[model samples]
Target: MATTTFSKLVVFAALVFVGQAALITKPEGPTIRTRHGDVRGMYAEEGAIFLGLPFGNPPVGELRWKPPRAYNKSWAPEVRDGTVPGPACRQPGCGPNKIDYRHTCNRDKNRTQSEDCLYLNVFVPRSVLLNSSLRLPVICWFHGGHYMYGTGSAMVYDGRILANKTNTVVVTTNYRLGVFGYLVTGEGEDDARGNYGTLDQIETLKWVQQNIADFGGAKDKVTVFGQSAGSDSISVLLTTDKTTDLFHQAIMLSVPFSITHKTQLEAIRVGNDVAKSVNCSAGDMKCLRSKPADDLIVAQNEAGKYIANPFKPLELFMQWGPTVDGDILPRQTVDSFANGKIQKKPFIIGNVREEAVLYIYEAFSKPMSKLELDGIMLAFLHGKGPVALHEYNPPKASDYRPFLSHFATDWVFQCPTRNVIRNAVVNGENDVWLYVFDHVVSIKSIWHHKAYCQDHVCHGEDIPFVFQTPLLLNLSFTREEQVIADTMAYHYGNFAHTGDPNKASPNVYTTGNVLKSPLDWPRYNKRNLFPNMNFTTPQSVIVKDYNKEKCDFWDKENIYSARNKGK
Candidate 1:
């Protein structure tokens, strides 16, 4: 209670776990000795990239559907080659919202996918080798896929630019997905309990605490970050007391606060449906386990038909993800933040201006009429349809499904997250920075997505700029795009370095006057009406309550809390 708002409950977990590391001579020639084993990484212009480092043992055979086991470091090989990315956990190859890392943009389909995919990648700045006393901050990224697809190994998630530009270690980790990750037998702790992915993330963070120091990262300065499902996972981690020792700060980007964590019974029912789909009895644990991974994957996809009711008014979220088990996540995520049960730590939580454009663009066969838009608002809010329609009014209908996406975006993503941020700052005395990403990148043209953007910025448009991946990957970016990218990297680097994004501490980028209004990012406390930074190119300005009226309307109707109980 006596500590400042920036941090509290600082960890000694790294000290206790890393006692033996100071005893061993650090590895030579771009290699580092982890508590588990020695890993040799490849050098890059930005930093040293250590790829496919298994943080957990393969979740294969008997280990499937169980809590992740620490990577068996006692292997015969003392030195592990970490240049190649580990196989992505077994997943359905292609879908509307999915990106097959192997065949993205219709590239080669040669990359492998497997159940034995519990690995992570680390990117450390090359400069770290010069100073043995220097300990840099770390940003551990969790890739988003509705908690059902994608991997850390994906090309867009390459951590090189972020590490090099930010002067901090960047880690991207892979966790189980879909039925493989979230299945529960309702058999309690002994059998298949859901949250394997969340547990894997916790284990992977533990691994980071033990080994990151060898790669020039400070274990105590680890900040876990993610977008979408990954952000949702961080939202869960904030609620769980067990993960307190693994992280110091947080950066959540566009959390779908409306998404519900599955109840134990709901998860068990879904698992039962999976078992039945695979021709195994509800209680046939062995049969389910023995089934081929691909068969299980198919069954998993098939099981979704039952969980999400298309005939129903709306299906706003994924059916499989973090479950509220008694162990890992004991309570609803939003409820935890609302009740002030979350750890009081600095946080940066923000959403995009158009978070739901892609959803509307992809799912709809034709553009919605104004009448249809009103119907959706009604369905999403149940009997409060007229009120929502009145609040989210659009005068003359545009070519696009004008108001539908806006309504869905605020209802599902923006407002609820804002609630958590304000709650943390106002109630728990935590420093919370808010932002709205309004930048539109040209990389969208290169992507194979069905969506188009003349003025719209889709969900995750902020990422390429954050990492400067387009420049690194040889994808073309306009001169302005590069500048915006630098601006983003500077802010993110500053945040990773010091808990505050506005203050550049250990990580400094001299962008003097290049960015308009490149100054203080005000905290969303009780004061100042919670003004937010609008992250667009050229200049980033502060806006008061960014989407105040819409968010307030939802708050008045209790839309945010209602979704937690709905699905």
Candidate 2:
């Protein structure tokens, strides 16, 4: 009897071990029904399964430059496995250092280029889909590389951590870039072609609406978030009617609605010039489309060299960006918001503390004078020179020029972000929360040594922290820094779950000034005074009296420029 009991006990132990292993192993792939046909995706990580599914037909041959069509054919005999990501859309070379110019001139190479690029990757936590009973929130992230470079496959944007931590489903997608995505093809049916990339994003969201439930996500609760140019795309999407009902909330990081096509006409002209250099007629769309891909890439490189700001050209004649085509974008985003046509949804918008400082620091090796500072202020503030000067005064000591660059930060990044908040508030959409990320990291070398004095929170510094991907920082974070990352992730996750970021489970560090919300970060209106939220060491809110005089001056100058067509 004792031997029999011992044998039974051993069997029970073996069964328990097997059950534990099963719990830890990745979940199985589930088939989801899409508009086109059914496709299956496999388990990606511990608590998530990612299906890199394609939604639209190949945009090639006669379909080139036209709106993407719905993919209708079913997969063949082999079971569909959305494990590997799709190729990026045909455009310029996204090399780590040099921008390849051969991408612009070659139609043959472009055709050979993978036409099956209209795909998106979805990440849904296994816990949320299989065990957890709750419907998870969905977040669709649009990658930013100036609308020129970047792909959805970048390691920094992996959604596994975000999904596991927030219990949310995350989706990131790839779309056409550069000329293929933004070229205006004249006033016929093609004039409607400027924003194919944006259209791709819209289609991806629609796909999620139809299929995300299989991954255990709430179709109605979707938020679109992007940084830099991606943020610009989010702003455009917010103002567009095509994306309405597709997403319920938006988070715009660093980019603003004021960034319009006027700032990018110069790049388009430069692209046109490059086409001409490659023996392609600027006026003949067919000729341009027929060129080899490598030649087009070379043309783009040549064009980049000719433009003054290769990174972000100041010339209007050589810019490349979303154009106000009557279809995708019926009107300018600024006009759309002012006219109240923009979708009325909750928004979370803010900028890093010292945005543009690193870019300027890298560009100019010299210190800026008071006059130069004021000039920049006037340019950005639209002539509100004195008001900005008063609020953001340079230190009396000449050595403080670096610190004084904060004026540039507030003018270019902070004020514009606030303007987005102001617009949302003016529309009576009070669901806007503003933040200023002042938590500076210790690694100054990554920022080219500018971190010594200015405490530069350069553009995009908040992304890794918010995503809890500190390892992407390329440097180790201190214990405190890790705490900051956790707090940031918690706050972001909270915002995703509920519209309010303050609703998250509070952490001890988060309760302190480090992660606390700014003081009185009130909604903007014509009547209410403009308030500034400071995300400093100890976060607090302060009602800032914007240098009214400088603001008025800039406003008047902008009005005059608009009347005179200086834009």
Candidate 3:
């Protein structure tokens, strides 16, 4: 059900869309002549907002499971309406009985869902829009939902505050999700070889390159940034030359690097499970496409139960994702980074402190027993479990949930992130910086249902601060929280303007209230004990080799799927 305020917002959007039907030579609000048409957007206190702009044609019917086609049709004579966001791409609800606030089902309630969802939203600051001659750096955001659920235009990712504070044109886009986006059959030409979502991202970058200049954004100064699955997509973008000309720099938040991308056969195994659930034969593209979207969603849920990634059991939680299709993604992400096959673009990559707490709680209803912990270690770490359990050193008799949570955090997010950084730097990829988001958000309502995340700096905790959307949610930020948000936006804004996060470009504007980092971040290197920026309260400072011993153990174990498995 939609809230009264949201219902009113929708009514207002409809009137605005209908009212601006005809083309006016000089409209009142901020107008931009895009390649598709002349789009008229609304003006707010912060800046101009252009929502629901199509970057690619609707991926429906024959287009399902195919690469996105650029939205080439023109709405010139009839002005294209950019008032409200386009419908979120088709996706499933949250975990079975669990109330995960992050899922698209909960976040995008009462909002339309459709296959015609390849739309992107643009947010430009009032100052930047007022000066027709000024072209600021652009930041393109990719929302994350484990590549299964999430939309770019959700209130949580409202780019207005970030755009105003960063002084950059912010773009949030929607791509296909679930089986519709990443179901793979086989290596045949007719097969839906996965990574359609990745292709959609590529098409988005191409569109930005062609049309961002009209919205006061420099195409050459584009920076791609995202969290979780979005970050995973950006990491893939960094490896392939397909995105070489699309973006200049990248910012990856909470990338699940340890959940190794599925091999072609592995993807096909899951695809077949989804197909069988719907009574369709494997590799039957026509049959799969003919089925209703609802059927596919249900099938996707059922498929997770039938298959598992033996090398990485955690993958069963996030089953539908990009596949190593040999074409789009030639090799695994870490392998590419380790072998120097990746583009040497400037990037900042990091993760939250207690990334796996929520996930751990969700996986276990109550505190885990020592036996369960031993089983987890054996299942996740293989022969390396005994050595790892010795290193982690959990209490034998008491509940081991905390130990499991910390271990999962280190094994899944923190250690893998450090591994990627180490690989990138060792392979001569410079201009890289690292950080750890250690502050827990003050707003408890965001995770009200998930009580375990109340005090932990869990996954997705940094999003509200990064976009500064607490005010939009009818909530307020504490003084310390506000400072942290300001500091993050400050560094991110500087990074978008200049390759270095500490330095701001002359072209970009900075306000008197903009917060600065307590210390200058140093380039990540093998020497100097690998310093990383610890983004925390009153002041964010540089820390040396966070969880160094734990990461060393994981690295030495050589258990990560892609490690020591040569390309």
- Candidate 2: tens digits of C-alpha lDDT, residues 473-549: 35666656665565555556677788766675331123233433333345444455665444544333444644445
Local accuracy by lDDT, each model: 0.74, 0.60, 0.82
Lowest summed lDDT across 10 adjacent residues in model 3 is found at: 1-10
lDDT of 3 by residue, 224-244 (tens): 999999999999998887988
Order the numbered candidates by TM-score, best leading: 3, 1, 2
**Residue 372, candidate 2: C-alpha displacement in angstroms:** 8.0
Let me know the TM-score candidate 3 reaches against the reference structure.
0.92
Each prediction's number of clashing residue pairs = 0, 33, 0
Q: Lowest-scoring 10 consecutive residues by lDDT in candidate 1?
A: 1-10
Which whole-number lDDT from 0 to 100 does residue 177 have in model 2? 71
Q: List the residue pairs that clash in candidate 3.
A: none
TM-score of each: 0.88, 0.77, 0.92
Candidate 1: lDDT of 553? 73
Model 2 CA deviation exceeding 4 Å by range: 1-46, 90-93, 96-115, 132-134, 190-192, 256-258, 263-271, 304-318, 365-407, 443-455, 471-476, 504-533, 536-567
